[model samples]
Target: MRLETEMNMLQAKIQAGIVKDETVGNTSRFSDANPNLPHFQDDLDIWLTRSERFAESKNWSRDKWSSSLSALLTGRALDCYGRLSSEQAQDYDKVKQALMKRYD
Candidate 1:
């Protein structure tokens, strides 16, 4: 009876260890397979098509096309930044003037 009980306990420990090892192995494999998954962009296809069209329209010179696209993207970013800054400045001035008037 004592020997049987010890054997049963040993078997249970081996089974539990196997289960824990399998779980850890599976989680590591899953994370490795999906590392750095990209965020899905709603207009990804449209953006790709536009980029291709732009490249083709310029006769597909790799350097020139890439440079042109880079410049265009930079200009757009700057324009957006300028607009945001101007709006923020106007709001700040308005608030400041309003506060001055209130105090006066």
Candidate 2:
């Protein structure tokens, strides 16, 4: 129920043009590059854990980490990533921390 409310609010924001649709778009800059990434499914912590493990399994470099993971984000998670500064967005650790904070 709480999650549904949040989704509705996010949808409303998108419709109002407050949160751009691009922020929640299913396609991302890195999607084509890394098609196997696990997407965020209304749970930041679980998504982050899964993404981190996926990154490790793929041996994704620190440089490519954030972009690769960003490909899988949607809804508020995508918005959180979009809100990051250019430098922060490039560092997976910073991106992770920011996302955890946003969802917390």
What number of clashing residue pairs does each candidate have, in the order they appear?
0, 0
Q: What are the TM-scores, per candidate, against the unseen true structure? A: 0.25, 0.65
Candidate 1: regions farther than 4 A off: 1-44, 74-104
Off by over 4 Å in 2: 1-35
lDDT for model 2 = 0.65
TM-score of 2: 0.65
- Lowest lDDT sum, 10 consecutive residues, model 2, at 11-20
Q: Residue-wise lDDT of candidate 1 within 1-104, one digit each (tens)?
A: 44543443333233222223465564222211121222223343454356556556546444333223222222222232223322332242332233234334
Q: lDDT of model 2 at residue 76? A: 78
RMSD of each: 25.9, 8.9
lDDT of 2 by residue, 1-104 (tens): 45554554444333222333466675333232363755678877777777777767767666776766675677778777677666777788998998889888
